[model samples]
Target: MSAPPLLVHLDGGVMTLTLNRPHKLNAIDNPLAQALSEALSSAAADAAVRAVLVLGAGRAFCAGRDVSAPPTDRDLELVQAVSRQIVMLDKPVVFAVHGWTVGAGFEWMLDADVALASADARFKLPEASLGVFVTGGLTATLTASAGLARAKATMLLGEAFGADEAQAWGLLWRVVPPDALEATAREAAQRLALLKPEVAARFKRVLNEVGLARFDRAIALENAAQQALQTGG
Candidate 1:
């Protein structure tokens, strides 16, 4: 039997979600999307899960959607659900991104409470150039993180950027050497898990309330635009 596309592991109050499609560089397909959505739900419901750690198996974090399969409205909805779930979850979410983090991968990284990238990490938002629109509340998060001009350039041009540039743009919490990336990320997540659950949850909630005020509106607009593009409207 093939391994599941998404791996879930819980330890020491930290729920680790690993993208398991290494052969395809953890590209998102419907199956992977579905699995991720379900896993996020599990994390949300599990009181034992105090913090979440997201990692990519093998070489890359994610190379975005599986182009071979194409995307549908279901895919868009699932991506939105995953994004919303991450934000709504009371626990801190940490992302350890490496290799190519493109399209939705880039957007999800923006959603993290803390995102750490490896020296070899590369990021891009290629949806506009590919004739599709971005999912996730990227319009809000990307613009807020990197500013309007840089976000526009990244989405329109689809250019790949390295970790240092991403950090400079305020997209990454920290940039570590490739060899230390995983360990460093784990430590961060564990530290977050160690915080008092009620206090930590309240802290995150207040932060999101202030920073992600436009997230829902952005998702709605992106969904409408993507639907129009797909339907030739």
Candidate 2:
């Protein structure tokens, strides 16, 4: 039997999905992304998963999209579909970030409700620096997290930041030691889950609307700005 693309574990109204690609730093490969999307959908409809926590099994949260395979239409579509689904999921999706977070793997959590970073974690938006102006909606999200000037510096300059720095800059809600990340995240999720599941989920949905619409607007602004930068406006 083939190993699962992701691991799903549900307990006490909290569903935690582990991106189980430690060997590849849990990069968002095609199969893993599709499975992750489906898992989010499943957790949303289960009526039992009041809150969802997404994390990686090994050293990293996600090292971005797997560039091992040549970029293709299928690859792009899969990632895009999963990203949209992540944004559409009603349940709150929290992330536990460790190691490197880049590319689509970073995009997946960009659609999350909240993020907790390990002290050792580092984040960078290298899409533009890689000759690709925009590979994901992260420029906007990261900008929203850290502000326009910081966002521009990070994305355009391809700067990387430590976890505590991320929190101070508003890139993450919280940061903890590497060993404490999972437990801390789980405790936080469980606290939210202890409340009425339906109510919690509804709150998540409403907050998503408020946050995501702004997120879209921010991304649009970034996109237009990026276009101008590339087009010599």
Candidate 3:
């Protein structure tokens, strides 16, 4: 079988993190999430990597968390931790989504400086259908992206949207054909790598504070909920 997904490749000034579990549609379990967090943190700590690119190994980017794994608060923790890291990273992060991005996996995109997706890629947020609140800060980011009405529809309907619809709704930065996704996004990442990492970092900071003000509040709320569950509250 192909090596387990989650490959971290470092080049001249860019770090590419590939979600390798294509067989499982790159599901994010605790270990995978932790690995992603560690990899992202490592990239941020390294001075040579000015920009980072995240892509899936095979067809899908991420099919959300693997529910078959024993459920635990750790699943949510892993995603939130990595998301916080992405939001706080000193370097730029560009998410290149190829196939599916559902539930928690969709929230990961919200943390990126820019998100590019293949035209064949799909998106959805189905937490409500599953009877759980989102822990990846999608509760807040969705409102910013699709407005309260569209966001509510997503939660209630839990249906998938194609790349065109996603881009039109401001949920994606750019969309191209599946074959062109990596090349297109990597080109953008390469350009970003040429800039001062601090510039992208500062832009990310200010954008969160100004444009995405509610993100901080959402994460705080999520953390409290997680802690309460941890304490059996």
Candidate 4:
């Protein structure tokens, strides 16, 4: 049998969710998408999991959708669901990204509470070039974090950028050497785990309320666009 797509481990108060399909650079296939959504849901429900850390195994973080095959409707829905779970989960969600982070994977990082990247990490938003709309409320989050002009250029061009560029664009909390990324991210997650659960929840709730006021609406609009494109509307 093949290995599972997601590996979940709880250490201290940090729940580490590792994307295990390294052969495809942790690309989001249907099974991987379902696994990620279920894992995040479990993290939200489990009291022992004070903070959640997402990592990718092997060479890269995530290469976005597994394009070897077209995404099914269920895959699309799960992708959006997982994005909501990451953003809406009361607990702190941290992402440590390296290698290629593209398409939906890039959006997942934006949905995260905090994201750290290795110096060699690369990012791209290829949805526009690929003729698909983005999920994970990226339309709102990217514009809010990177400003309207930068966000439009980044999405419209669908060009790849380095970690330093991503950090400069206000996407990453920090960019460390490739070897130091995991440790740096763990430290951040541990610090977040120290916060009182109720306070952390409330902090995230209020901050998101103000910072991501358009998140839900953006998601709805993107979903409609995606459906239209899929149905040739």
Global local distance difference test of model 3: 0.83
**lDDT digits (tens) for residues 1-233 of candidate 3:** 75744899888688999987888899888778988998988997789989999998877889988878544767767888988888778788899997888877888987788899998888877766665667777767878888999988987799989989989989889999888999999999999899976787787788877867888688889777656655668
RMSD vs true structure, all candidates: 0.8, 3.4, 2.2, 0.8
Would you list the C-alpha lDDT of every candidate in the order shown? Answer: 0.91, 0.75, 0.83, 0.93
Instruction: Determine which window of 10 residues in candidate 4 has minimal summed lDDT.
Output: 67-76
For candidate 3, the C-alpha RMSD (Å) to the true structure equals 2.2
Per-residue lDDT tens digits of candidate 4, residues 106-156? 999999999999999999999888888888899999998999999999999
Clashing pairs in 2: 64-102
- Mind giving the per-residue lDDT tens digits that candidate 1 earns over 39-144? 8888889889989999999999999988996679998998888888888889899999999998888788888899999999998888887899998899999898
lDDT agreement of model 4 with the native? 0.93
TM-score of 4: 0.98
Total backbone collisions for each predicted model:
0, 1, 2, 0
**Model 4: runs farther than 4 Å from truth?**
none
Ranking by lDDT: 4, 1, 3, 2
Pairs with backbone N, CA or C atoms under 3 Å apart (clashes), candidate 3: 5-20, 6-20
- Segments of candidate 3 deviating more than 4 angstroms: 223-233
